[model samples]
Target: MVSQTSHVYRYRVDAEDTIVAVDEWWLAFAKENNSLDLDEASVVGKSLWSFIADHATQKLYKEIHRFVRVTGNPITVPFRCDSPTLRRYMQLTITRHDKQHLDYESVLLRAVPSRRLALLDPIQQRSAAFLTMCSFCKRSLIEPSGWLEIENIAIKLRLYREQTVPEIRYTVCPDCEDHFGSNRQKLESSSEQPPR
Candidate 1:
């Protein structure tokens, strides 16, 4: 028997076991269970396998063998492509048995988003604001606090003129704030003075 270990987990297969064929069977099994989305199917299947691999009983193994025997058909799961060129179109197929002994036809596949994504239906547009750096200080748009400050600054700038007192006071380090305040005072004084 061939056995493999991943971290704390151990997996064993019979000497004649076909890993590739088993993968195909699982893929087909997922489709039978109405899990057409490959990513979701994979996630669920992997979780299930991890559980089974760790604590699989003889009964559970026999049940799985029965499932494969009854289905007798190739299964396919759809997967969305992360690639820009084929971003939304792809699928993966799995069969019950080895390819060489092909009892069933090749599994058919088509891309479909996961059920979770379908439920949420998030906007597909990318946010330019998230991609760009902060406009005022060239700081990267990283960290939750930085993002919050950026949002606050944008809102404040839009609602008030340059001289208007800020409604929402921003907290900066005392040293930095003092230096900035001094620079502002110098600029104002320079503007007020008459040309020499």
Candidate 2:
């Protein structure tokens, strides 16, 4: 039986490198946070790389597995994944095994979202002209007052409402900074809460 550990993903693989089982908590995390659509039972015959969408990450997984399989040595590495929607820092721990019941490699991954990364994805892509916008409200508090219109920013970027691209960036517009700047306690509390 697999034990439950928050933020950790535990799974076993057969000698053939097929995923045989997944832990309960890992399934919950996959459903709630993973962008990949995977079923607890259905994931079993598939290659672990099949569920990973990022090209760079996929390559990383391949290299790591190849090394372990060839050398029969255990390895542990920490890496980060950043996309338009989510950013995570994860530790990949791989161990080689030859147990009677499960004779193969097993991976125990523990990941945490980067405190520096936003929890939510951007509504749309930024225009060619980059703009500093509010994270909570998704608006530009640029000079001359009020939030900038999506259309105008689009024009500057030479993009259309139909073509805005989502990307990752860090900012806290003056409006928010000013409003909550003095109220550190309120700002901290509110920031911890997901945006409405």
Per residue, candidate 2 scores C-alpha lDDT tens digits across 78-133 of: 43333223334445567655531132222334333332222233344444544555
Count of residue pairs whose backbone atoms collide, per candidate: 1, 3
lDDT of 1 by residue, 99-124 (tens): 23222222223323321221111223
Candidate 1: C-alpha RMSD to true structure equals: 27.4
Checking candidate 1 for backbone clashes, the offending pairs are 28-75
lDDT scores of the candidates, listed in order: 0.30, 0.47
Q: Give TM-scores for every candidate, taking all chains together and pairing residue i with residue i.
A: 0.21, 0.45
The root-mean-square deviation over C-alpha atoms between each candidate and the true structure, in angstroms, is 27.4, 16.1
Best by lDDT: 2
Cα distance off (Å), candidate 1, residue 166: 32
